[model samples]
Target: MERNLMKGNEALAEAAIRAGCKCFFGYPITPQTELSAYMAKRMAKAGGVFLQAESEVAAINMVLGAASAGVRAMTSSSSPGISLKSEGISYIAASDLPCVIINVQRGGPGLGGIQPSQADYLQATKGLGHGDFQVLVYAPSSVQEMINLLTKAFDMADEFRMPAMILADGLLGQMMEPVEFPEAKTHQIPKPWATNGTGMKRKHNIINSLYLTPEELEKTVLDRYKRYEVLENEHTEAETYLTEDAEILVAAYGATARVAKSAVIKAREAGVKAGLIRPITLWPFPKKEIVKASENAKHILVTEMNMGQMVDDVKLAVECRVPVSFFGRTGGMVPKPSEILDKILELGGAE
Candidate 1:
């Protein structure tokens, strides 16, 4: 296969177009703006529509509109921009619209910085919007993985009739790496519930999120939760390194996972039985793998580019069986491999 060096954000845009993305609606935000810019340059040639919406809120609603037509639509934004899109995201989820959302994360709280950070873990996994809903969230550690997972995100969003997200960060978005775009295969799934024209042969389908009656709303919510249960059982993914007989475990995702892998290597060279578990799916959250990895581990260190958002999920997964500690760098600061190695060694009683 031929490989090309490409920026992560641009690679993701090309991947989405190849994956059958028909429409893109997004506002420019640092780190993620490249993705939208690429789409603007390429989408029309691919027979797709690319519109830079007036704001993040408008962009997400545009995605919802496009998705209701039963077509692959997407939107991209950074941390604060994602916050602005949250309400529209919730509406899409409630309406059972399938769409892809790209979040190239940056420092947070309130427009913190343009540099990388994973502070949106809680927002993405726990409280994306003001509703009881979940979107499929994939965390990619490299440019190539970002391409692969974005394709999967489109497929899964269609399969489950809900939104899916690519949870990337500034580091991954801005960095360049060699990546291969495999021959594209058509994976567009059929949607029977779409509001597209019916050709007068079938009943007109309605796409809506509003239910005036309490009973109707309750029933709809319950049905959506059932689909979520099936999704949880079927599509959780994680990657483990050197955890077969390890005494210490480290949990991380996205760019932080790359650093954690290096730290694990250093610990191994020093004869400290340390291993790493990287979660590829942040929403369903690879809990089963975490439990298995924790079985023979003494302590688990959760590292991120933020102040310990994913640590809460790790603790829940472990069920308090092992000590779970957190080490992180916030405000656009990234944790160095040496820093993570020190934490691993300290957990291994080598420091």
Candidate 2:
């Protein structure tokens, strides 16, 4: 396995291609535009389709169509662009189509700034659209993790027959790091429900999200949740660092997690019993791991590159067992290791 120095966004594009993604439909948005550019330059040579759609909504719908036809498909966007694609994401969820979406986040409530932000945590974890549906969300802290997760995202999407998202920040997209791609994987079995030319042997397969009857919709929603439960049990992923004897725990994810981990090491070196629990999968959220890590912890500090979104989830997971505090940097500002270390020291003394 050889490594290559590449930007996170470009690494993701190459990873998608190696993962056998057959189509990429995306709109160019800052911090992530390089991803689409990479795909545009290379997809044709890989014998894949790369179309820069007119708009984010159009791009996502194209992904939906490709996935329904049983091909690996993907789309990438920033925060504002992701908002535009929400409707199509919901439709894909309802249709149970497999596709990958990458959201390299920027500050937002409405196009706030092009700088990196983790403000989309709530949107990605909670249903991003108008329904009771979930996308398996992976938060990658490093360029390597970005490539790794994007590669796995395709398989996860196909395995569950749903959309999977890579929730990255603008910083990760712009940073360059060494990454090794996994060997390309092939689908072992055929998708029988795919509407990829019936060949007259089987009846026409219908791919749709429209359930006209309320009862039918209810049943579909219930069934989808049942599958979500299975995913929760099987796909929860997290990383625990020096949590065994720690008195303070730092809960973070994505780029914030990288900074938090550095603070943890600094805090520990300064004689503070600090540790970190980084959620890799934001959807299932590794509640089991959080609870387990909480056993030896006295206080939990949730850090984010936004104004405290994932902190709520941390509180829910901790369940009043320990006090949860939040430290945030909003509007695309990233927290420094020294700042987080200071907070850890303050929390350590207070607790």
Candidate 3:
């Protein structure tokens, strides 16, 4: 297999194309603009459609349209832009449409700087939109994992008939690393519910989210939640490092996980029994893995490039069996490995 050194944003776009993405509709935003640019350059040649819509709202609605037609569609944006696209995201989820969303996150309460931050963990996993709907959220810590997971994001979106998000950060998006593409596998899922066209031979399939009758709407939402339950049970993913005899466990994801892993390794070398648990799926959240990884732990530290968002999840996952603490940075600032190592040492009582 051959490997190419590529920026994370470009690698993600290429991976989506390889995953059979047929339509790309996105507006340019800092940190993630390269992904849309790559899609624009390559999508036409791949017999796919790439359009830069007038706004993030337009872009996401376009994705909804393409998804209704049963094509693999996607859009990319940064943090604020994602907020603009949230309503359409809810529509897609409520309509049971399948599409991928890429969020190369930046700092933010409003139009924050274009530097890496994992502050959007709550938005992606909890409140992507105003509804009782969930999108599959994958957090990639490396450029290579970004490629691998983007492909899986598309597949899983189709499999579960819902939207999926690649929850990446600016550091991962702008970084360069060697990545190998997987052999292209054909997407073979049949979309019999698609509103493509009936050809007058069959009844038209309507793509809609509005249910005027409250009971009908409740039924539809309930059914979607049932699918979500199955997804949670079977699809959660996490990575654990040196956790067997660990007395101190660290939980982090995406770019922060990369830093935390380094810290864990340093803590171990310094004679601390430290471990790291990196959640790959932020929605399902790998709670089971975190629980198991922290079972033998005396202290658990949750770290992120935000104000302790994931710490809540980590605490809930372990059910306060072990004391949970948090370390973080925000507003486009990233946590350093040495800082995390210091926190680990403090938690391990090695300092």
Which model scores highest in lDDT? Answer: 1
> Against the true structure, candidate 3 has what lDDT?
0.93
| Candidate that beats the other on lDDT, 2 or 3, i.e. the better one | 3
The TM-scores of all predictions, comma-separated, are: 0.99, 0.98, 0.99
Tens-digit lDDT string for candidate 2 (192-308): 999999898999999999989999999989998998999899899999999998899999999999999999998988889999999999997899999998899999999999888
lDDT of each: 0.94, 0.92, 0.93
RMSD of each: 0.9, 1.3, 0.9
Write model 3 residue lDDT over 1-351, tens digit each, in one string.
988899999999999989989999999999998999999999999999999999999999999999999999999999999999999999999999999999999999899999999889999999999989999999999999998899889888998899999999999999999999978674649999998889898998999999999999999999999999998899999999988888999988998989999999999999999998999999988889998898789999989999999988888888878899999999999998999999999888895
Alpha-carbon shift of residue 91 in model 2 (angstroms): 0.4
Q: Which ten residues in a row have the lowest lDDT in candidate 3?
A: 179-188
Where does model 3 exceed 4 Å of error? 184-186
Alpha-carbon shift of residue 271 in model 1 (angstroms): 1.1
Clashing pairs in 2: none
TM-score, candidate 1, is 0.99
Model 2, CA-based lDDT: 0.92
